[model samples]
Target: MSTLAPPVRRTLALTKANARLLVRNRTTFLYALVMPLVPMVIVFASGGASDAAGANAVTSVLLMAVLFPVFYNVLSQVVTRRDELVLKRLRTGEVTDREIALSIALPGVAIALAVAVVTVPVSLVAGLPLPSNPAVYLLGALVSSVVFAALAFWTAAWTRNAEAGQMTSVPVMVLAVAGTLVAAVPDRVAQVLEATPGGAMYELVRTGWYGAGGVGDAVEPLVVLAAWGVVAVSLARRSMRWEPRV
Candidate 1:
């Protein structure tokens, strides 16, 4: 019988409003939820051929899929709020900038987590096995979510409008997917991919799920992920705008 703290409550309110706005935009909602999953659905519909890659590959792809909705949805929140003058009013409140950023990200994180949960059982039935190391899988997913959300906030600062924001996010989404696409290549190429932002995490989660080991195994990817985290947060803090874009 405990109530949510003020910050958490505020975050929830922001998320709820953002969701309502999304639902009202039918086309955007459709694209938000559907586009990223096209690859997954196509693979699964083909009788889970690529799905045989193991739990790590399946979960990695699914986590990457969450990026489509989370980044765009959160970026759209910042852009739309600026247009509505809601962001301007928020600046006058006692709310901290970090809190504001978290509130904006709150909805997308929830959605991603829900998708992670829902996708697990469905993935198994589709031929991808359950993750052998669930903790590592969940940790990688969690880290990926925060990294993307922070990156979205960082981008939203430069965005002049919703269209501009959408366009800007395209590169990031491309980078993330391209980074993970290393799985389709040879081991040497994949080793290179393991150093890129999402690539390392993909390999990390995959190996961890499949129970691989070595001293440097966790070090490289963890370093890369942490570096991205620092970069994303610093950019957001340095550039976030509270006033209207105009």
Candidate 2:
């Protein structure tokens, strides 16, 4: 008798299904794709000459790209799925909670990566300096994605419904955006902001863009990001509901 596929394969199939839904949904299209492109077009056209300015602009846009898929999209989708009883039904299947969560998260992560890839060439064409250390820049972007994904899951745990998710997601989104924009101000305040998840990500990416020395330099921001992820994952596991909240 034929047997069902392994959990990994099933998760991949679920990812594809989720991705299809993402593409068809008009609201998802607005936030995930169109939103990032709007700022990108403006930045690309305005054009900064200095490397520092260019790096800041490029990183800002990248952060915006990261925000939608990793934070907004993931939170909205997860909460909606739970509200609709999809998560409860999926729990009866062979797929573990981890698999279910990952499958749900896959579309956003994939879109974020795709945006990062395309943004690189476009930024270069727009006259921004290419990251001096391409590998490190990519690493920073990947870490940011993971960190934000965890944050999304954590935030969704408290979010009551799809509409509530929009309100709930704002604080984290504001923190992330504000951190990048304020990263340049010199003082203890900047230092404090640097400790935030968004700030840590901004510093890491900016450092990489400048081709800074050994990875040792990045240890602090990496540690901060990892700490946030740990906390988020713990909270998500404890609080995230499989059934609709009542």
RMSD of each: 3.0, 2.3
Per residue, candidate 1 scores C-alpha lDDT tens digits across 1-246 of: 549998777767776877777777776576656655555653355334543255335545555545766777778888778777888887788766767777777666766666666666766666665666666666666677788888888888888988887588877777676666666788898777666666866666665555556434756676777788789889988998776676
> What would the per-residue lDDT of candidate 2 be over residues 111-139, giving only the tens digit for each residue?
77777777778887887767776776777
Which stretches of candidate 1 lie above 4 Å from their native place?
Answer: 1-3, 42-60, 186-188, 214-219
Model 2, C-alpha of 84: deviation from truth (Å): 0.9
- Consecutive 10-residue window with the lowest summed lDDT within model 2: 46-55
lDDT of 2 at 176: 81
- Model 1, TM vs. native: 0.84
Worst 10 residues of 1 by lDDT: 43-52
Hey, what RMSD does candidate 2 come out at?
A: 2.3
TM-score per candidate, chains pooled:
0.84, 0.92
